[model samples]
Target: MLPYLRRLIRDEDALLQYSAQIRGLTAGDIYIGSYFSVAANWLPQIIQAFQQAYPAVHVHIEECANKVMYDGLEEGRFDCCITTWRPFSGDWIPLCEDEMVMWLPENHPLARAEVYPLKQLCHESFIEPLPQQDTDVVRILKEEHISYETRYTAIDNYTTYRMVEAGLGVSMNNRLMTAQWQGRVAILPMDPPHTITIGIAIPSRDGASPAVKKFIHYVQQGISQILAPR
Candidate 1:
């Protein structure tokens, strides 16, 4: 416990020094952790614009699973994180809403339906992505009491998409993640119409580095403007 306390003290000291540097608004590094799909779909433009505004303040992003990202933020390994809202002990503010949609083979019988039956998931072979993790997709299935048959477990979203395209199974994913991908899979909204709010999570705003607060505020405003009804 002595060593752990010493390490904590050192970390605190370093954070204070870093915070001072960022408060000057001249330069400092801010580390951000994010979930894979959120980073792929939402972070590029935000990071680019942030750098343009604060060129000397370097931003480092580390992408991992949702649970890991949340844990990292709590442990002080990340100044902030971008991910879906979950039962996390962190500060989360909504950025945008992403619809959860089903991906089925274009030639599949259910593909013709206007909206896929939510209960029909039990009858289809399901492609589970990131089986080891409790993502929004998996949580939705459990909450809805949908016991799906896992025909295949994919390591990532693209793999799951390909599996559905090949008729191996159907899978659900956030629509924004596949916006740029064109494939033989049919993306359809579910009967119940599920949606997840993607957001920024930070340990807390109090005592946070200036860079961290600036980035979060800028991202919030930017996304709000983009999503505002035109």
Candidate 2:
């Protein structure tokens, strides 16, 4: 009789209630994915502003390289990513465009030049960020038959900056990252200027979580405010 009673007393309502509570607890969590290099420049301000705006929301930030960030976004591991290099998929939002500039030690010959031509700069020792795939700079060098020697290769912008600063080699980087190191390194604008597109990538099938959406909005607004005519 006791065994039969246990089988008949199914607490389906209670089970559903427990599941609902679990889902509710997770609903407000936001997971953001981005490359360490770009994040190094923009994330601190973005996160601080976001936390101030929404103190209740839990923010999970995953910092990785560009390729890993893209892969994680595609695999549903992250809510979104802020990246300069866009994936082939069409689900990203265009945030901003930043010009790529050449970084050299202050004492380098061309460091004093207002703008350096790509062809001429290609003759010197170069330090390039090793992207997972061919980048625009690599394509340019190949197309133009430029034969610059690669002194060092780094996986992140910070390391590249340090290398260039140490006089190990010269490299090209986006303006946003270079902006923070103004006096530390000499940034020469590239002639026939090159620019890279930076943007946020989110899943197309489902809308981002409320917190994630708010953060994205914050980033877009913050960047616009900073870059707008002053």
On TM-score, the candidate that comes out on top is: 1
Model 1 lDDT, residue 42, Cα: 60
lDDT of each: 0.80, 0.70
Best by lDDT: 1
Residue lDDT tens for model 2, 1-230: 55334322322322443454467531255667865545777778877888887776677888766667676665556667777555456377887888878888888888899997878865677988865545556765676577687867887678888888888878877777765664557888887777778788776524444556677888888878767998
lDDT of 1 at 168: 93
Task: Tell me the deviation in Å of residue 72 in model 2.
Answer: 1.1
User: Model 2 Cα displacement at 30 (Å)?
Assistant: 2.1
lDDT of 1 by residue, 1-230 (tens): 65456447535744764766657644566778876766776678877888898887778889766877776665667778888876777677888888999999999998988999889988999898888667888888888988789889987789889999999989998888797799999999998889998888877766566677788887887777667899
Q: Candidate 2: list runs displaced more than 4 Å.
A: 1-27, 35-38, 131-146, 182-184
Candidate 2 global CA lDDT score: 0.70
Measured with C-alpha atoms, the lDDT of residue 39 in candidate 1 is: 72
